[model samples]
Target: MATEQKILIIEDDTFINRIYKRVFSLSGFGIELAQNGEEAMAKMESMNPAPTLIILDIMIPKISGFEVLKRLKGDVRWQKIPVIVMTNLSEKTDEEKALNLGASLYLVKSDHNPREVVLKAKELIDKQIV
Candidate 1:
């Protein structure tokens, strides 16, 4: 069998993080969790088989999602990883900023359920079109 696709979620909210883990688990996706940008960076560096996708929250405790996106985009090795910015911040500026920073997609947390987000993620991965 082909290996399961891995997904990394960079989120600070403990409750939401656990929920996403369960959701992705049931969907046959290997999952990794990072509470903040620092942890996320460390995880990314050590991931031998890098994750196929990343879901990043904009308002994190230690470092903002924007900063993380910038770092990932700035590095050639990590630049191709597809990133989805999942945030409750629905302002137009915030959405535009994330897209400008190389986020493949921007999702509003309040607007999408767990299932919806997972489906979207799968669609993105399947397309391979970003």
Candidate 2:
């Protein structure tokens, strides 16, 4: 088995967070959770060794996912880490916005099950494709 890669998942919905935690855990990923943008930023700063990847939600409270992506991509420390924008935003504009801001992948939540998301995440990390 590959060494488990850590992922910071920024999602505000309790049910969704729980689902992500469960799925990721089963897939051999270490998870760090944050409910809002402020918490996300703080977690990023405090996570020991940092996270290998990030799963971001756009409609989160405070800072907004777009802003979070901007901050992450702008910072030298987090720029190279892959970010997957798993959001409820389904419009082309939203997708473009996230991609423009440096999201490595954008997946609309309603279109994919949590397990599918986890699989995609694993592939992304394995390929080291940013």
Candidate 3:
């Protein structure tokens, strides 16, 4: 069997993080979690094989997800990693900022269920492989 793709979920909410972990794990993707932007950056830096996708939350502690996205897209080594901005903020400006900062997709948490998020992640990862 082919190895499962890894997904890094940067969310500060314990409940939401657990949901993502369970859903992705059940969907056969390897999972990593970061509760805040600082930890997310540290994890990304240390991971040998980078994650296939990143599900980021904008309201994270320490640094905002926008800053994280900016830094990731700025670094050549990590720039190509697909980032899906998932957060409670549903404003057009926030969405635009994320996309402008190089996020692959922006999703409002209330609009998407865990299954849908997992499916989207899979689709994005598949596209990357192609």
Q: lDDT winner among the candidates?
A: 2
- Encode model 2's per-residue lDDT on 1-36: one tens digit a residue: 565578999999998889898999988889999999
Worst 10 residues of 1 by lDDT: 121-130
Model 3 — TM-score against the truth?
0.96
Q: Return the number of clashes found in candidate 1.
A: 0
Local accuracy of candidate 3 as per-residue lDDT tens digits, 9-128: 999999899999999999888889999889999999988688889999999999989999999999999998999999999999999999999999999998988899888888887798
Over 4 Å off, model 3: none
Model 1 ranges off by over 4 Å: none
Higher-TM-score candidate of 2 and 3: 3
Report lDDT (CA) for all predictions: 0.91, 0.92, 0.91
Ranking by TM-score: 3, 1, 2
Question: lDDT tens digits, residues 1-130, model 1?
Answer: 2877889999999988898889988899999999999999999999878888999998997878999999999999889888999999989999999999999999998888899989998888888744
What TM-score, over all chains together, does every model reach?
0.94, 0.94, 0.96
Instruction: Identify the leading candidate in terms of TM-score.
Output: 3
Ordering by lDDT: 2, 3, 1
> How many pairs of residues collide in model 3?
0
48 Cα displacement, candidate 2 (Å) = 1.7
